[model samples]
Target chain A: MWDEKETDRKLCIICSKGTLDMAYPGLVLANAALMEGIDVTIFFTFWGLDMITKREMSNLKFTPIGNPHKMNFGNRTIGIPNAVAGFPGMTNMATSMIKKEMDKLEFPEIPEFLEMITDAGGKLYACRLSTDMFQLHEEDLYEGVEGIVGATDFMELSEDAQIIFI
Target chain B: MTSREIAGKTIEFDEDGFLANPQDWDKDVAQELAHEVGIDELTASHWQVIEFSRSDFDERGEAPTLRRLKVAAGVPTKDLYELFPKKPAKKIAYVSGLGKPHGCI
Candidate 1:
């Protein structure tokens, strides 16, 4: 029902975590918004920058340690008792299980989904502060990344957009 | 019991104008339905989306979500968004002569 480009709705997503669980929430919502014709921009900062950095993209892991939600089986979950999270190899086991399930479902890997979203016109913004602090070069980021932008620039770009912190 | 005349055929529609029987839809009917929904013309690309949506409904027995369109129908998100704009699921359902979307209104 939108008639004008100037009036097009925009969604600005802030990804502050690099965990696989956190990454999907933002990417899925961003893709859904783009499918609905809403302009979308994802700003990655701190650990979130790990999601876009080429060297770290495939390494986004699921950490069961300290997570209140436990590993779920088909019907039930082995809710992590905080103490049990410290057991040797528990986090790695959980991560492997999640990856297996993702593979079974044929979900595109993190890098592929990021490319998909960008190909669909969703803009990916890397935080300049995070880049400088982490010593990340522009070449180290994914091909989809539009640029390294500061908080001020992001705010200006998102002035008319709904900001979603994920 | 509302009905619309499309391509010289009397087509039944629900009160909300969704096709009462989606099987009655054809490409010609789609062009007319598209216009009723404010889509002035149906390009080949538009037909791709509409056809994909209708075929998906036929196979799935429900309106296809925009997410499914991207994943299964192979319609790029940029194309889907540009073709249907805000709320592609509902708009595509309307133009494709399918029922209203069950999710996300």
Candidate 2:
């Protein structure tokens, strides 16, 4: 019953987490929507602001503490206990493992992914409150970010649009 | 399997309107397909993308994603959007007579 030609669909993704694993879902979904000719906007808040933060975007860590899923490493599956996951270097280990898998699958890094989205005409925004709390400025974020806006502005921008929170 | 006449030849298309067989594609077919999608003409830049896509599909057995096009074909992302408009990935696949790209991003 959905008619794409008759309707201009829009998608708004709320990215609230900053983990390497979490950061990708929002970016991937935003890009997918753009590929479908849907208008897309991503709002970054809380730790999610790190996704747009220049210094931290590329170095996001994958914390294994709360992840219960097993990871596959070239025919070997490994599960890290919560205790072991908290140990030093575990985060780095997990991050690198996932990053390698992502690369093998041809997924780009976060900054490049953001660039792809921007090039496709997808809009990116940072939460003003979060920027203030994190002491981040416009200059501290990725150059492609359109603006740092409040919740109300986001609501207006995403009016009648389907929203996904990641 | 549905078929439509393109460039004076009856070409089979998948349920999604993509060419059922990549071998059925030709430059004239591409020009007609591009016109169906609101592209009045296929310029030299368009030919570059189409040629790259066809060769890439022959090697990979699947259509290339926008990222692959940008990285491997030396086409920039902005230029791809300009060439194909609203949905560059799907448009390129459609015009190139290949299956839709399966990558999420």
TM-score of chain A of each: 0.89, 0.94
Model 1 steric clash pairs: none
Quote model 2's TM-score. Answer: 0.95
Regions of candidate 2 where Cα sits further than 4 Å from its true position: A1-7
lDDT of 2 at B22: 89
What lDDT does model 1 reach? Answer: 0.80
| Cα lDDT, all candidates | 0.80, 0.89
lDDT of 1 by residue, A36-138 (tens): 6689999999999989999989978887777776567788787767677778887677777788887665566789788768866889999999999999988
TM-scores for every predicted model: 0.79, 0.95
Model 1, range B15-76, lDDT digits (tens) per residue?
66578888888888888777665678888888888888888888879887665677787887
Candidate No. with top TM-score: 2
User: After aligning candidate 1 to the native by TM-score, how far in Å is the CA of A77 from where it should be?
Assistant: 2.5
